[model samples]
Each structure stands twice: as structure tokens, then as C-alpha cells.
Target: MKALLGLFILMQIFIATNAQRVCGTEIYTQKLFAANPVIKNAWNNAEVQIASTTKAATGFAARDTAANEIIYIPLVIHIVYNKVIENISDAQIQSQLAALNNDYSYSNIDKINIPAAFASLAADTRIRFCLAQIDPQGKKTSGIVRKYTVKDYFSPEDGMKISAQGGDEAWDSKRYLNIWVCNMASRTLGYSSLPGGLANVDGVVIAYDVFGSGEHVRAPFNKGRTATHEIGHWLGLKHIWGDAICGTDLVEDTPTQQYYNYGSPTFPHVTNCSPNSNGDMFMNFMDFTNDGCMNMFTIGQKQRMRALFAKGNLRNSFLLSFACDSTLAQGSALPAVDTIAVLSNKPLPQNTGLKVYPNPTQAGVNIEYIGTLNNISKTVSIFNVVGNCVYTGKLTKEKAYVNMANLSKGIYIIQIKEGSNRLTAKIIKE
Candidate 1:
């Protein structure tokens, strides 16, 4: 009787601890794998293919050929909402997408926080994200689809990827990365389908409150890292700990971890699985840590994900997508290109106390420099809603004016760059 009582208590404790977890990808993936055994088979086959390609000489030749170029992914977001707040604004969606691009391309400013021990292991996936300018049918789109649902909330098990199930159906997952933003019950911030999942539902689903950085965003999970983490899963990266004790995440560079690390574990967190001084990489995106605590993807992880885009893989179709074609004739003109273009493979410098004022100005805004910005080859560029650079100018003074006389009434990004150093601010033209 005592043993039975103890077991019951332990089970309850386990349930409570799991309730605090912010990611449901593991559970969702397992459920999908069980429901469709073929999914698992496909995933295993894809892994075998990835191994063969990486091992063969032909793979090295292909990697070298396209190694210097940046691969841009076109994305489509489906906003499923019951409450008005769940329908996040276009600005919030853009912010999330910007965060993804910055993280994936190794341009996020916070990357400086990566500890020295694991710094070299970090990698630039060389992947950039852009909102789909054209739909699958060649029609112009805002890249955001908003749908009203009567359901109070959604669960990972629910058919949230289907319109008949009170959720918005995904776009062509092969062509466009579809993200569903809604209010998910429980603490699940988000979940994503892996590369070999059902094609129609092959995307990510995020809780609206945790989907973006600013409005309607919850603290600790508001930095848009949830989507970034889930996208890692969509791209074939596993949890840093591999969801088991001393488990292998299949990446050679990442240390074996005992389990997921929650909250902000200090640097050099030495678990039993990784007793070395360098410790487990609790700061990886795949861990169960808060948004602010996660920073990087290892080179091995990057290589694994990029393999999905290799020829004959499940996600190879994305390479043929022209959703981001700038010349495609459509409804309204595309927004300005993103500032701080993917100029080189170098990392972006940290922000140096530069600020843009009169953010929501109808006339013009002032660019305030805290220190000496002159005597350097620095340029100021403004990007419109669609990430096109509308204006580019040289900064000759500490305080400069960015004229908004010819700009439209919407959000724009102000980017200042000096060499590899880049700073950006969002401005609203009223």
C-alpha cells in the first residue's frame, strides 16, 4: 500500500512539472509518430539520406557550390483567434519574422551573450525569412491570414491545422512556411510538425500571446524565440537533451545532456551527463529555457537542417518557390527591402547606444547617436513594411533627420550600420 501511494504521488509530481513546460513539440511529435507509423519511417529514411549525402563526395561538391549564398524562405502566417487580442497586429507578426531572420542568419544582437566555451560551436544557418509576397495561386498576399474561430482554445492534439476544426488550414507547406497563431490552452507556448509529417499540416502553431515581442505578448516568452525554436524542429533539429537522460541529440558538437534545462540556468551548467568543465549547452534553442536564455544552434545542428533542403528531400520543394519574387505583378507594391542587407558572412556588431526618436512621427524622425559615429563608413537605411530599403543616407552628424515626406502610412525599419555593426528601430508613419 505504501509503494502504491508513493507511486501515485510521484506521478502527480511529474504531471505538475510537465505542466510548467513551455514547449509541446516533443509530445506532439510522439503523438503524430504513433498515429502514423509511416511518418516515422519517412523520417528515418530522410535521416539515412542525409547521412549518405553528407558522407558522399557529391554532397561536398554541392555544399561548396551554394555555400556562399543566402537561402531565403517565404513564410505565411495564419492567425486563428476567438478573442480580439489573439488576432495579433501586422507589426507583431513582422517583428516575429524579423526575429527569426536575425537568429537564423546569426545577426541577432543578443548573440553576444553566448558564453566563450560554446561560442565557436555556434553557427549561421545562412537562412533568411521573408513574408510571402505571392500566394500559391500567384495572387498577392499580406502573408498574414486571419481567421475567426468559435473554439475557446486549442490543444496540440486538436486538428488546429484544419479549417473545419476551428482552425485555419495551412498554405502549401512545401512552398510556404505556415505558422498558426492562436491561444493554446495550458502552458504550451508552441508546437511544430517535423519535416516528415503530413504535408497539409507540416508547419508550426504558436500561442498568440507568445508569438511576438510587443503587444499581446507575455513576458519571458515574448522575444519571439518560441517560433524560432519550433522552426528548428520543423527544420529537423532535436531538443538539445534528446528528451532523455544522457541522451544524444544526434549532433556531434553538442554535449550530452541529462534533461531539459528550464528557466535561465547559469553558464557552464554541468549536469551528470556532461560532467566536464564546459558542461551542457543549456542555452541552445531546443532546450526548455525561457526566450531570453536561449541563443544558438550548433554547426552540427545547422548541417542537419540544411540537409533537408538537399535534392530529393521532403523540404527540397521550397527551393523552387517564387513566393518572394520581387518582380511578380500583384495587388499593391511590395514594401521596402530589409535594411542591413546580407552583405557578408561576418557577424553583426553589438548595438552602440544609437536611438531613433519621434518614432510615430508624421513629419520626420531624429537619429540620435550617443557617441562618436563619425569618422567611420556608416550609413542609415530605412526599410518599409515589406522589408525593402526605401532610403539610404550617410550619417555626417550626431543627430540626423530621416524625412518621411514621401513615405506611406505604415511601419518602417530604420537601420544604421558601421562595418559589421548594425542597429535597427521601427518607425510608424502616421
Candidate 2:
């Protein structure tokens, strides 16, 4: 009777601790794999290939070290908010970007806290993200899609990925990273569709309050690591604990962990499966630690992430995605005939708002074409302070980048003309 009671108590401990940091990714993927066994077969085969190819074999071309050029992913953040606070501010959204860049680039200052044992394994993934300047239809966009959702909470089965279900639809997952920030049901901080999952549901879903590092965001999770963790899964990384007891995450440098770690575990937190005195690498982004506790991705994990982008692999399509460079999105949208340019002298519509960012730009400037100016085809002309047209580009409802790297440092005027409507904004190139 005592043994039976002890077993019940142990099971309760497992159940209670498991609820601390809930991520639906593993559960979601397992359901997907069960529904379609072919997917599981394909994933297992791909893992074998990835392991061998990324193993630093002599004479083999490694995906990560190839030229060492950074990979920039274009993102379209879909904000589905039912409440005012759920509709996070742009500053909060921006804070998530800053956190991701710092984490992936190894530029974050908190990295200094990593234990000396695992510090040598830390890696700069060479991956970066940007709000997509050009959208799927070749239109100007702020790369932000905000829609009021009647459904206050979404489940992991992906009601959030379908517009018919009161959630915003995903963009072309092959070309742009679709991030849906909303209120998640079941206390799920976040979840993601893995590389081999259906494209329509491919991407990350972050709960609003835990999505960014901005003020008033939840403690222990406000540092934007939820997005980072889910995005890591989207990029083909498994949890450091491998979602199982004494399991393998498939990365060599990351020591095998008995199970997920929660809160802040003291250094040298040993487990039965630990390979050395170094113990578990709970600081890995793939672990279930709090946002501030998680800090690095190992070199082995970097290899796994970069492998998805190899030629003919699942994410190879991103290599050709020019969504990051809006200059290449020429005439991606059509304007209503009534909104055609009447004349450059036409008065500016009161509803039209023009916003340019990083005004004193060293190179690229993002011009967001929104409000009444959205979708209407317009001519974008850049003139020097002396009024000479030095550069010209096409503009529509979509946001695009105006390359000023080649132009001499000075003040410039950006003019957009559509029918009798004209909007002009001044920007300085530093």
C-alpha cells in the first residue's frame, strides 16, 4: 500500500511540474504525424540525412559556413486581438524583433551569464528577421496584419491559421515567415508548425502577453523568448530535453537532459542522463526555462537550423524570397481606376498617411504606404534638396525599401502621386 501511494504521488509531481511552461508544438506535431504517417517517415529520413551532412565531414559543403552570409527572413506578423491589451503596441512588437536578433546573433549582453562549461558551444546562428516590405501580391505593406477576432482564444489544432475561423490567414509560408500573435487557449505560451507541416498552418503562434519584452508584459516570460523558442521549432530544432525522459535532441554538443527544466535551475543541475559534470544545458532556447534564463543555441543546433535551408530542402524556397528587398517587387498590385493619378499637383487626401522609418538612414529606408494610399498605384520619385529626380520607383498598397546606399549623404524628398492625390515626405540620408 505504501509503494502504491508513493507511485501516485510521483505521478502527481510529474503532472504538476509539467504545467509550468506549456508549449503545444511537440503535441501538435505528434498529432500531425499520427494523422499522416508519411510525414513521420519523411521527417525521420530527413533527420538521418541532416545529421550526416551537417556532421563536419571532410570535403563536404556545410550549410552554415557557406560564405558565412547572414540569412534574413521576411516576416508578416498577423495580430488577432479581441481585447485592447491583446492588440500589442508596435513598440512591443519591435522589442520582440530586437530580442530575436540579439539571441540569434549572440549580441545580447545577458549571454555573459552562460556557464563556462557550455560557453564554448554557443553559436551565432547568422539568421536575422525583418518585417516583410513586399507582400504576396506584390503590394506595399507595413508587414503587419491586424484583424479584430471575435474568438477570444485559439487552440493548437490551428483554428487561428484560418480566416474563416475568426483568425487571420497565413501568408506564403515558403517565402515569408508568418507569425500570428494572439490569445492562446490552454495556457499555451506558444506553438509552431514544424518544417514538414502543412504550409497553410506553417509558422508560430505567440500568446500576446508573453510575446514581447515590453513593459507590463508577464514576468519570467516577457523577454520575447516565446517567439524565439517557437521560431526555433519552425526552423527544425527540437527541445533540448527532446520532449522525453533521458531523450536525444539529436544535437551532439547539447547534453542529454532527463526532462524539461522550469524556472531557474541552479548551475550543474545534474540528472541521471547527464554526460558530464556540466549536467543539463537548460539555458538552450529549446529548453523550457524562463525567458531570462534561456540564452544560447549550440553549434549542433545551428547546423540543424541551417540544414533546412540547404538546396532542395524544406526551407530552400526562402533563398529566392525577395520579400525582404521591396525594390524587386515591381507592380505587384493594381489600383482602382478612380484612384489613378490625376496630376502631381492634386491635393493630398486627408486620410492618406505616409510614414518613413530610420529617417537618417545609412542605406535602406522603409516607406509604408497605408491609409488612403494603400493599394492605389502610385509613382515614387526621389529628388535631391535641389529638386533633381535622382531615383524613381513604383509604389502601391505595399511597403517597399528605397535604397539610398549609392546616393550621396543629403536631404531628399519622396513624392507619391496617384490621380489628383499627392503625398510628399522628407528624409535625410546619413
How far out, in Å, is residue 217 in model 2? 1.7
* Tens-digit lDDT string for candidate 2 (1-430): 5455345334434564433667888778878987989988888887876776567422255544355668889988887766546766667878898899999988878899899999999999999998887878776555776665667698878887897998888899999999998888866888999887788988999988887795757878878899999999998999888766787888888999887788988898998889888899888999988888999999888878887887767788888888888786654322111121112234423333555666677896776643544624777777775456788877754876778899999877666666544445666788
lDDT scores of the candidates, listed in order: 0.74, 0.76
Model 1, span 245-273: residue lDDT tens: 67677777889987678778888888777
Which model scores highest in TM-score? Answer: 2
Query: How high a TM-score does candidate 2 get?
Result: 0.73
TM-score of each: 0.72, 0.73
Q: For candidate 2, give the lDDT of residue 377.
A: 71
Minimal lDDT window, size 10, model 1: 335-344
